[model samples]
Target chain A: MEYAYYPGCTLKQSAFPLDRQSRKVLRALGHGLTEIRDWNCCGATSASKLDDFLEVAMPARNIGIAESAGFEEMLIPCSACYSKTVVAKTRMNRDPRLKQEINSELAHQVRGEIRVSSILEPLFDAARSRELGQRVSRQLSGVVAACYYGCMLTRFPLDVDLRDDAENPGFMEAVLEAAGGTSLDWQEKTFCCGASATVYDRETALDLMGRIFSDALARGANCLVTLCPVCQMNMDAYQEAYCSRLGRSRRLPVLFITELVGLALGLGYKELYLDRHFVDPAPLLREMERQQETEAAS
Target chain B: MQEQTAFQVSGDAARELSAEIAGRSEQPIASCYQCRRCAAGCPVGEATGYLTPDRLIRMVLLGDRKMALNNDLVWRCLSCYTCGTRCPNGIHTSRVTETLKQMAREERLEPLHPKTDSFHRSFVKTSLFWGRMNEVGLMAAYQARVLWSCLKRRDFREMRSEISSQTRFGLSLFRLGRLHPGWTVSRGRRELGRLAAKSGRHSR
Candidate 1:
């Protein structure tokens, strides 16, 4: 199963580990990812906040490029990119005049036939087909994960349609279960992490992030796994700050779903890029490894 | 302790704002029946004073353009869309907030949250210049903007503290290879520039 991949700006820099792990995990599952040629930024919340034309034009250019590359479906890993691209495509396809206007702004023509899908879609599909289970050499039996789906992944039910229940999604839980990990039931699964607010309004963003961390810890989650880069960055990088601010000493490791899946497939820590996380996940991974060894001996 | 105050209908601003919001989002503001469900779901509504999702729509209906535009809540919105998704009338409060932010910039209203506004501008400008987000460039530009404002207000202590705190985080990200001072140009930059220029014209 080959698809045109769109790894947005965050994945290239701040979220590079996500890109590496995603590619590794997909290849391990016998799927191929081909990047969309000459893709630009998806013009996230910033572009849409500033100008309407830019919001539509930026994502339309990437979609047009994908269509021109002879691909009917493009895989986007970042939730923000997926949401922005899907929203742009839906609006453009619905309005002929808007479509024409956007096309005039772009070098390539948007055929409006291409579909944009999240990386989770293919992984979930593989799980349903039992290919994922077949490839898992190591079962993450002892790892309890709180699957966090930030706003963009399932925000617009009518527009994106990525999940059945946008408010209370179980897609990630299913994928985690297939990987042999226990998915914890938590209320903050779909809560907002205040996203870019981390940069602008640190206090408020930290407050929001702290709430998520506290909830996951209270629910017996050893670590938090997420599909969105922004959520991962906020929860992982700011854990210390949140803990210190709240006078708490507990730390929770946040992992991308791809990394967690890669580990279950017997991929090494170095291969999964686990060391690069802000809050080290090494201690938790070692604990898991120790448990696996003892259980195997028993 | 409560006094009855009647707000006289101002000519056209409220009506124009409501019409423009309807035109952009395609949701009828009149259908909002003050259920406060949107506010209930909003994460930042309480934190943001006087601009809850329901109240924002109510203000728009009342044609209180000054109050809606002047409030800091417009800029503080996280655009999470929780309120919008849960709206019984299907009115997207997040989209309405976006429209309000754009209008506020056009009307040259002062942002209640200056740092957020600066970051938003820095993000777009960096995208426009580099065809991708240059994290280091964005922080540098944002710091310059903040420093200039601080100097203008004669707040030297704030300027120093802001620079130091930002530098601390920037250094960490840089050491982690998550940020670079130089440009990170993507393919088809020239085409992106052309498209951006054309879109700017259309937006104007």
Candidate 2:
């Protein structure tokens, strides 16, 4: 299967691991991704707040670019980007005036038509059931993970509908099942990590993150897994900051869904971008390794 | 501004907003039992003081237009629908809040919160003009309102790196070269005028 992929801005920079692991997982699933030509930002947090028309046009430009690439569906991994693009498409499709205005403004830069979807949607669609069956190597027995959808993935459910149940979502449980891991029943999975506020308001962001982490840990989750890079970054990076600010020793490993999928696939640990994490996954890795060896000897 | 003390909404407007809400939501607002779940789950309310979903609903149910318009909670909502999903009674608190905001803005009873109107206006202007947000512009505007030092020192490097990377990915603020050529101040005025005209013609 071939797909048009829009990796977004974050995947290339600080959250490079998500991009690397996502591609690897898709490749292993026999899908090839052709990057959309001259794709632009989805105008999520800042853009949406700035100019409504620009928000639609910005993602529309990239969508048009992807459509021109001869791809019907565009796979986006970042939740923020996914929300923005899907929202833009929905708005443009609904508003003729908006469609004309944005198209007129971006007549030069844009090409083709794009139908945007989150990376999770296609993964859930194409490979989920089969990927579950292929899990013979290692089963993450007894490991409990909190599957975090964060806010972006579920926020605009009407537009994107990527989330299974907007009210009480647990689709991640099925994905986690493929890795032989049991996802915990946690309330904080759908909460916001204060995505863009990490820069402007560290205190509020930390308070929100701390609440999420504490709730998940209290429920006995070994780690938190999410699809959005911002969520992963905030959950991991802010753990240290929160620990320092509050005077405590705190460590909770944050894993992108692809990283967990990579682990289940028995791919090399470093290849999954495990090294880039601020909080080490070594303890969890060693424990999993030890468990695997014990099972082998037994 | 003496009229700004509060635009006392009548039973007619509250009933109208509630009826409009019911038409869209298919859920009754009067069923709300004052369970603070809506306020409890709100992400924006965690920061903005006293902007509770329950209180807004209370105002609507009681037809206390002045109370509803005066509260900052009416417009502070991010419309994430956390409250609606969490509400056992199926009350659409966000919709009620939105109608309140529209009514409040119309009656010139905008809450005297710091920079709230400016923030909303700037956000809408950015979206309407460029069809996306200009993050740099938003950051500059927000920072100007909150104070420069709140941004912290040495954060520019990080912000710059982020900006450059987004530009490479085609999410640049500079890309919004101009608003749609037809989107002039007069066009907006015309649209608003048309809306007011339509509403006026229909009201009779």
Which candidate number has the best DockQ? 1
lDDT for each candidate structure: 0.82, 0.64
Candidate 1 clash pair list: B14-B63
Model 2 spans > 4 angstroms off: A108-115, A135-142, A157-163, A243-248, B1-37, B44-49, B54-79, B84-204
* Residues B54-149 of candidate 2: C-alpha lDDT, one tens digit per residue: 766766665665676556565455555678777888775655555555555556663554344455555444433433334445444544544432
User: DockQ of each model against the real complex?
Assistant: 0.58, 0.09
Candidate 1 interface RMSD to the true structure: 2.4
lDDT of 1 by residue, B1-204 (tens): 112133335657767777878786566778999898888877776577556888888878888777766565677789898887888888887888877888878878887788888888888777777777777777788888889999999999999889888888777777766664456666656666777676653222
Candidate 1 chain A, poorest ten consecutive residues by summed lDDT = A156-165
Clashes of 2: 26
- lDDT tens per residue, model 2, A53-119: 4445657777766776678778889888888788777876776776665555443333335656777
* TM-score of candidate 1 to 2 decimals: 0.95
